[model samples]
Target: MSQSPIVLTGDRPTGPLHLGHYVGSLRQRVTLQEQYRQFVMIADAQALTDNMGDLSKVRRNVIEVALDYLAVGLDPAKSTLFIQSQLTELAELSFYLLNLVTVARLERNPTVKEEIRLRGMERDIPAGFLTYPVSQTADITAFKAALVPVGADQAPMIEQCNELVRRFNNCVGKEILVEAQALIPDHGRLVGADGGAKMSKSLGNALALSADSAAIAAFVRSMYTDPNHLRVSDPGQVEGNVVFTYLDVFDPDKAAVEELKDHYRRGGLGDTVLKRRLTEHLEALITPIRERRAQFAQDPAEVMNILRQGTERAREAAAATMSEVKAALGLSYWN
Candidate 1:
């Protein structure tokens, strides 16, 4: 496979990956692996920015997330899958970039704002949480990445990163850092089974990527459909239906799905039937992914080795960038 041209993307190791991740980004990462210089970081350090006290969870999830990456066909040979904490250069760079960014500016960032609200920390947001965007800027510019795949909600982050890049280059008298473009996925957000706006593990609305067929089917069976569509004979609503939502994503028979929607709207179509189809569709889709995950599960050490090797390569590139950044700032004491 050819290298990923120059893409920097990763997941926070807060928990195991779910179907939402697959639809939102992992599928694209699998496709882009051979096309870009992909750097997939298991962002444990970044997770600490919010979950500071949950070190055990962070520590355990690092390998679990790596397994998910390998299981999803993120070729360690093609994509650099690294543990973010291993690269000290990123921390060093983040500190310098923090000096260039202001607290008020970070507060104004949409992603941070939304996250602060979500965490219900209006009274007491952590300092590390506030500075995460700067650390993220460091993550991208440390490698001089040209592209960062982000969801629509995360566009502000890319803007913030670029803003820092511009300010840094202007202050330092050279454009040593590269401005990254956001590659937003076509399907931005995948709603949860409970009809929640976001599919999240904490909400118990997410189906694990590694979920078993029975587990997936159960989740689908319990999925939230249109609350108003109470009976099979009643005309169902598809415009805001979560069953149809999953169908739109997982169902391959687009014509069949469309037909089902029309039948449901015209009356006589049942939620059970629609849910059964969705369950079948998800089973078909997840079966192969589950099999792949099982295969990778046998070789846990191999997965760790892949992560270690990627970390080495990632550190080398980051170190090179840091050296240049230090020289740019006339801060390199080693000459």
Candidate 2:
């Protein structure tokens, strides 16, 4: 049987991906590549919406993010991996989607509001940052992507995209755009090593995908556990402990993880032992990815070539969609 139509998902190249990205979406992306038509976008333009002044950082990190994808085993043969700014359709589609979505609607979006607060930009929010949801509609619909994988916190973004899709199709009298479904993971969020609410580079809590073994080991070693479990004999709280949480996600030995949790909760299981085990588990998980990343790093030209080929394919698809979109809106007559 033929496979379902394409699914689009991606990340801004603000930083290397972390464990939160892995558990929250990237791991799923690697697996979904086999089942669906996947287009993995490196959203450099989207990153610039927030980092407008830091063009050099955004430019540099695109390569970093692409390398991370390769290190994680995202096969270019199976997944169309490309940079976002390379396609002109996104700009055109963004214009159309903006007209469909109101400024009030963008303001009401929960994710955008939260981000404004988080970035401390109550009054000075960049226009591009405010309009990214519209741009994202462009990214998704530019390829007519049917599925958009995201975390719960990002569901509103997908809702905004679909809302624009429906409005555009209805207004133009054609189903030219596809409505994308949000695929949220079972793990709602992944906490950082410092026990922050989320794993992030800005917070100094991320264990980067490209981190060397010593760096990974240090981060894992310094990871937060149950603060109340100060003594080995003290009963520990496993519910929110970072170590146990990591164990829950990465430990293939579920029975052993359960045993460790029980022992820790009952007292006598020290944080040191649990932390060591978590470190070992993380090492096993990260070592191969790091090794693969090193090999890819040795051939930067080859990596760029993969990205270039993917960009060409993505541009073709985006161009076709833009032609239909323009024709639907009577812009084709202008040419």
Which candidate wins on lDDT?
1
lDDT by residue (tens digit), candidate 1, 1-335 = 33345789999999999989999999899988767888999999998886777789999998889878877788888889999999999999999999998888999999999989988997499888888999999999988899999998899999999999999999999989999999999886899998888899899999998999889988988787878888789998898789999888888889988999999899899898888888888888788888888888898898788889999999998999999999999997877
Question: For model 1, what is the alpha-carbon lDDT of residue 328?
Answer: 93
CA RMSD of all predictions:
1.8, 1.7
- Name the TM-score of candidate 1: 0.95
Tens digits of per-residue lDDT for model 2, 1-335: 23567889999998888878888888889889999988999999888886878999999988888988999999999999999998978998898778887889999999999999989998699888889889988999999898898888898999898899989999999999889998887777788988788789899899888777688778878787777888899999998788888888888999999998888899998888877787788888888999999999899999999999999988988999999999999889766
Q: Check candidate 2 and list the clashing pairs.
A: none
lDDT: worst 10-residue window of model 2? 1-10
TM-score of every candidate relative to the true structure: 0.95, 0.95
The Cα local distance difference test for each model comes to: 0.89, 0.88
Q: In candidate 1, where is summed lDDT lowest over 10 consecutive residues?
A: 1-10
Regions of candidate 1 where Cα sits further than 4 Å from its true position: 1-4
